[model samples]
Every structure is written in structure tokens, then in C-alpha cells.
Target chain A: MTEEPFRWLEAIANRRDYVQQQIGTGSPVFAVSLEAGILLLGVGSGQSKVFEIFDRQAMAALGHPADIERVRQMLIDAAHLEAFTRASADVNVRRLVSFGLSPQLKQSFEQIFQAPFMIDLLLGEVAEHPSKDVLVKVNFDGGFKIQHGGVMVAAPKPEQVTLATDWLKANLDQKLKPESAALVLLLAWNSLTSGTPLPEKSEQPVKLPDALVEQLSDKVVEAAVLERKGSNVARYVPLMPLLTG
Target chain B: MNTGIAGDFLGLLAQNNLRPLAAESSTRAPEQTHATTVFAFRFRDGVLVAGDRRATAGNVIVADDVNKIIEIDRHSLLAIAGVPAMAFEMARVMQVSFAYYRRSQLQPLSQEAKVRALARLLRENLPLTLQGVGVVAPVFATVEAQGDKVVPRIYFYDPLGAQFEAVAFAASGSGSGTVRSVLSFQERFGEVKPSTMTLNQAIRFAHNVLTVASEFDAATGGVDPLRTVWPVIKVLDANGVRDVEAAEHLDARKEGV
Candidate 1:
């Protein structure tokens, strides 16, 4: 059986893992100017979930943790407006996302006295008229690019992208199921953390079970701990009941 | 970091050796072309702002298609009179100011705040207005959120930036007297309530007033069907500000005007 049925869950898990990695690193290495960190949009369905990751390091650098919390609260307060279905038909979703973030960024500039920080966003949607599945990358400066039928990464180094793309090409088929897509992303994350060489391609791509995927996610977190703390131990935040239940 | 985006903007301007206009200036330039006859009124949903297309230098008609209505943001509209150039510049700056605030703050300004900001800009331009070289009268209109409902707020400003909030309607420029008279007549005898008038009725009323102003005042240009150069009319409501296109004016044009 293909992993198509579990794609949404996998996408959410992928975002959670990526955010965890960034937080573990204690640096905003993955910060993009795309408003929220990641967004999963069901194209024609108009269903979407936004994963907003607040960068502790970035906020700490700004010397205003309270301000960061305030910004997050503001985002939560305005989350309804940021919903995909709330966007006007004439307006592009990516532009709407930028618009949603503009007020907070403006306020930060006014109150925090810092330059605009980068916001990263990933948008998944199904396009009508043309009838295509699309994933869009959006930046804080209201810039965006569209991607189709592949895993797209934002704010990654050249080497990381090269490795991730290599794994993606080798493993992903034209009709990518959610689990396989998540596995490909996991392999890329594994490569990034392990600094290991890319794996050789086999005739049949390996299938990753949900349990194994979780284990691999844990491994990625462990690697982050080793890199940051010189140990193989790390603490993981439990998934929110709203998300897990 | 900064107390507000406005302060930062001023700081940046000063850093670049630019200064905002003072309440009074020491020097004045020669008289320039000034636009006339812009007005706005509160209606059922929001506010309707209308402006004549004529620009005049004394008695001479300098231009016949000057747009006096400007949308500062999605929710706010500005109708300008007096020095066309200065008014346009003020509108442009106001647009950027609102956008900058929204972009940096990630939220739109309240309607009252927007009107106050425009008034402050006008006050800063007082020096030029005092010299009679850059006089501009602007009527600002916006729809504001209050509790569960939204209401329209309109304000008109003088050369020195004194802002007056209008409960029902406001008018400015050379043809204001004629427009005011028409508005007063409509309020006194017209069967329709000004506040309860539908969007269509409000627009037609503004057009009729402007048409009358054109008959009495050369500075107020009436509708030109052949050229399709109608007055700038905009509506600011729950859906935001949008131009009432010239095509929409076809049905609103007065007969035998």
C-alpha cells in the first residue's frame, strides 16, 4: 500500500521534527522570512495548518524574550485571519501570509528597535483551473516561489540542499505518498546531522513505517544533542494533546 | 527597539538630511495649480468620498483630469484640494506611512489613528500653506471597527492641520460653498436620511451636488461622458476602499447636466 493516506500526518510530523532540530541547535540557522515556519495547505480543499516556530536564539539576540512571547500571542490572536480559507479569491495565499505578518513585524520595528527578521513559510495547495498540487516558499520580504512535485527546503545551505535534493531524486516518485515524502525528508535530515555521505540507490526504494520514522526522528534529535552538548541525550517536548489526540 | 514606526521614519528622514515641513515656513514660492471641490459623507455601510477632476491656477483651467481622491490604505481614503502637487505628495507619503506601519507592526492602524496622522502631516505643512503657495485641504474617510460592528468616520482638515470630524458630511475647496448649500437642502427637504442612504443613493447625491457646483463654479468640473473623465469617487466600507469606476457613473449621471 502507498503512503498517500498518511501524507498529512507525515507532513505535520516533518515540520515538528524540523522545528525541534532548529530549537535544539540554539541558532536561527533555519530561520526564513516566510511568516510562520511551515504551512500545510490542502490545495483545492482549502484546508490548512500553519506551524509557527518561534526562534529562541533570535529572540534572545534581540534581548526581548517577552517581546517574542507577545509576538507569538499576537500571531495566535490573528491566526483566524491567516487561515487559508479566509484569504480573498483575488489575493494570492502567499501574499496573504505576508500581509498577516506585516503588522507584527512593523510593530516589532517600532517597539523593539531591530531590523526585520527573516520569516520562513511553506504553503501546500491544490491549484484550480490548471489542476496541480503546489508548494510555495515565502519569505519575510513578501517574496515567494512555487514548487511542484518535489520536496522544497527554505534557508538551507548549498551543501544541505544538494544532499537533500539528491536523496529526494533517488527516493521520490512522481506520485509521492505522504510517508515516503516524510522518509525522504528524514533521510535528508539524517544526512544533515550525521555529515554522512549520500546512500547508494537500490532497485526498490525503502519503505519507512510510522514507528521507524519516529525512531529516526529521535535519532536526529540525538545527533543534535551530540553536536551541541557532546552527548547522545536529549529531551523531547511531548506533542500537544490537540495535535496528538 | 523604537517606541513607534513613526519616530523611526522621522529619524531616517533626518539622517538623510530631510526635514518634515514646519508649522510655519520662512519662504514661500509662487502660486501653483490647486485642485478644488472634494467632499465625503457618512452612509449606511461606510463613507463615500468624491472629488472634482478640475485643477485651476487662478481663473485659468490648468488641467481637466486631476484625480483628487487617493486611497491611503485598503480601509482609508483621502480626498485632496488646494495645491495639487503638494496634496499628491502628502497622499503618497501618507500611503507609505500607513504601509510602513502595517509592514513593521503587522497590523493596520485604527481609523482614528489614521485621521490623526493625516492631520499631523497637514499641520507640518502649515508653513507652506501660510505662504499661500502650497495650500491643501484634505478630507479623510475610513471605516473603523467598534465592538461587534463597523462604523464610518470622516474628517476634514485646514491648511494649518486643524482637523474637524463630520457627523454627517464635509466639503472643501473653492466649490465647497455651493456643494454645502446643496447638501444642506438635501438634509432639510430630501426624504432620504443621510446616514441611512444606500451606497447608490449616497453616490448619486454626491454626483448631483458636484454637478450643481460645476454649474455655479468653473473650478468644479462636471461629468464628461464622451471623455469618460468622471469625478474621483471612492467608497470605504467593511470590504475596504475601492474606486467607483467611471463606468459606474453612467447610471448616476444627472439628466440634462
Candidate 2:
């Protein structure tokens, strides 16, 4: 009977390995708080990877299509209900992660009888200024951190995520316009996906390959921004035109 | 629980059995606060929606600064002429619902869906409407894109939730009888049709219609010239809702400026 507990633990470990393997091949999604707004960049294979969750909040996820869509719908339902029952301004990232999504994800992950979610997501909320922008990275196990500013990355492996964020911390310019920011994101993506080591912090940032830059016009790029100076209450805008222009 | 993109805010609320209110006893109704005098008309630029700033309770004037014209979204305006509490709540729900639909579905709700959403809310409020305490007759105005061009569309609803499309204009509340008469007569015999009037002329015509209503109905506050408070007027065009400047809509100048 005592061996049963150990078997449960072993099962949990096996589940983690299985989920990680399923997600290992997915691309990384990036979010950077810029002077223009919070820029979210994600590349998808015909499916959308970036979504606007509310007026001031957006998300980018790399996971199974069904899992990503489920989380998207769940967040949308909760956000609209909160704005309806309370006020729009009351809907913030902290409450959503702390009181809503984190708990739901934790429960799903820990429950022995249910399948776990295979998703890693980055949620970005724009504020009146860049310093106060709320950027969060949520893992499949429901763990997250509130990145007040700077940049965030969601990748299949924790080591890849660490390398990319460390590299971004040294090189990213927060004031880049949408087009320039997208190029920076592509460079980080290239290093992560190609398994190439990024240059040292003191070294110049690397340029994206010519073939990859040419492939951007094919529309695989899904990008959006939460505008800081927007007049409308809903500030999320698709940035495809800005990037291509 | 998974409503997906086809889900609606109100439907989600209903699935959770979260109706706005529980039906209390309809008997022994009290004197509830009511708003009065709201109208809309098609103009050359687009549509003009206006409302008097008045709320009354029983035979007494309760407030003079109650704005009845509510902006539902960028492309729509809702003007209520009945119970202020109920109407305002309905307007708030509509505003949030429209935004929720667009965000979740990644597209704006169709115009037909928008109108039907309002009708559903009014029908749900039928219990209160029958109690003589929550009757609301409202006018809704929007601009529809027909091909490359946009046209103004106005609709009015009865207390029972029946909606009718207005050919040229719509009016509601205790003062509606007067507003309808003047607008109808002017449309046929005035110097210009209401549809042909420019934005400047439409501003004057809106003030005249509400002013005439105030003279006939005690509930309508009309234009408060003493306080230099003009009616709340908004213009809806292809670009969306824009507030008419006081200088454009109000004829009188401030004391010395």
C-alpha cells in the first residue's frame, strides 16, 4: 500500500515528461514593453497565436491549438464577466492570474484523473506608461511571474526561455517602433529555434537571415500591440500593417 | 462552459441564471423616477440624436441634469425616455456586451444582431414594464454601411419591446406627441426636408423640436437657456459618434464671453 504513493509520484513525473515532449517542437512567443505599446510577436503555422483578451490586455501562446483556444476563450469569458459585474478599469492582470487562471491551471495540472494543459503563454497589459506595463509568463504547471517591464518570453523549454530573456535583457531597446521591434523579435526567435548561441551582451545584436526576412511577407507573422496613447478604451490593435509598411 | 466565439455576454449571464433582477410583486407600484424627451432624425451628414436633461418623479421635477442619450458603441446611440434606472442599466449592459462580442469573436457584431440584442433585453424586462414602474420607450440610432456609402437608420421601441424602423425620425416619452407633430409637418412643408438639412440647420431644428415639446409637456425640460444648458446632441456618421460643440448647437452666448 505504501508503494502506491510512490507510483503516483512516478506517474506525475511521467506526465510532465510527456507534456514537455509534446510542446518541445512549438515555436516561442515574445512580448516586449515598448514606447509605442506592448508588442506581442508570435509565428504560427496558419493558426493565430496572438489574441486580444480585453481592451487593455493581450496574450501570445505556444501550445496545442485546442489548448491555446480553450485558454483564450476561458480568459475572454472571465474578463467580460468581470467588466460587466464590476467596472472595466477593475479588470487587471494581477487579479486574473492570481484569482482566476493560475488556480484553474494548477487544479488541472495536479488532478490525477484529468489530462493536463500543454501550453506556455505570455500575457501583456498596457498601462499609461511603459514602466507600469504588466507582462507575465505562465507555464503549463500554472507557475507565473509579474514582469513589471522590460521583456518576456514563453518557450517550450525553461533553459531556452532563460537564454532568450537574458539575451533580450542585454540587447532590446524598449523605444523601438513596431517594425524595428518585430525585427528584434525575429532575431531572438532565430537564435532560439536554430539552437545557435546568441552573441555576448557587449557584442552587436545579430541580424536575421536573408531567407527568414524574405519569408516574413508570406503572412506567418501574427503580431499585435496594446497602444498606450490610444483614444479608444479597447487599445489592442493588430500590427501587421505597421510591420509590413 | 465553453461558449466559444458564438457566445454572447447576456447568454453567458443567463446560463448562469444571473438575470438582472428577480421579479418582485408587481402590485402597489411606487412613484419611480422617469426620464423624458428624446428623439433622433436623419440629416445630410448622418444622424442626429438628442435628449432633454430632465428626470421627474410623480408630479415633481427630481433632477435637471439627467442625460438620457447613451452612447452604446462607436456606431450606435441609445436614447431612453422612461425609467432612468432600468434604462441606464440596459444601456450599460449593451455597451459591455457589444465590446465583449467583438473581442471574443474578433469581429464586430452584425447590425441585425445589435438591434436584436436590445429587443431581447426589453423583452426580458417585460415583468417590470407591466408593473407601471419600469416602462421604457427608447430610440436607437445607427449608421449602416450599404456598399461604399453609409446611411442613417433610426428605430423606436414601445414599452412591450416592439421595435419599428423610423422612415425619417423617431420620438419618445411624454413629449413625443408634440415632437412627432412638428417634425412631420416640417418634413413636408418647411424650407427644407429634415434629410436634406445640413448639420448646422439640423442643430437648430433639434432645439426647436425639443423646445416646442417643453412648452406642451411639463416633464420635458427642453433647452435650459437660463443655465445656458442645451440638449445633449450627438452626430453619428461613418467615422462614428461625435459630440456637437456648444457653439454649434446652442444659440445663446455665455454672459460676457
Best by DockQ: 2
lDDT of each: 0.56, 0.85
Candidate 1 residue B199 Cα shift, in angstroms, is 2.3
User: Compared with the real two-chain complex, what DockQ does model 2 have?
Assistant: 0.60
Writing each residue's lDDT as its tens digit, candidate 1 over A1-245 gives: 12454764565445445533443322112111111112121111111112221111011111123433343333422331222113213333334345655555543333322444334444443232112334555433335566542445543344565666566566555343333333344444445655655456522454443543554432221100001111111111111221100
Write model 2 residue lDDT over B27-113, tens digit each, in one string. Answer: 887789989989999888899999998899988999988888888988999999999888998998899889878877778988888
lDDT of 1 by residue, B120-212 (tens): 778777777778787888888888888878888888888888889888888999999998787777776878866778777777777788888
In candidate 1 the C-alpha lDDT for residue A39 amounts to 17
lDDT of 2 at A46: 87
- Whose lDDT is greatest here? 2
Q: What is the lDDT of residue B158 in candidate 2?
A: 90
DockQ-derived CAPRI band for the predicted complex in model 1: incorrect
Q: What lDDT is reached at residue B16 by model 2?
A: 61
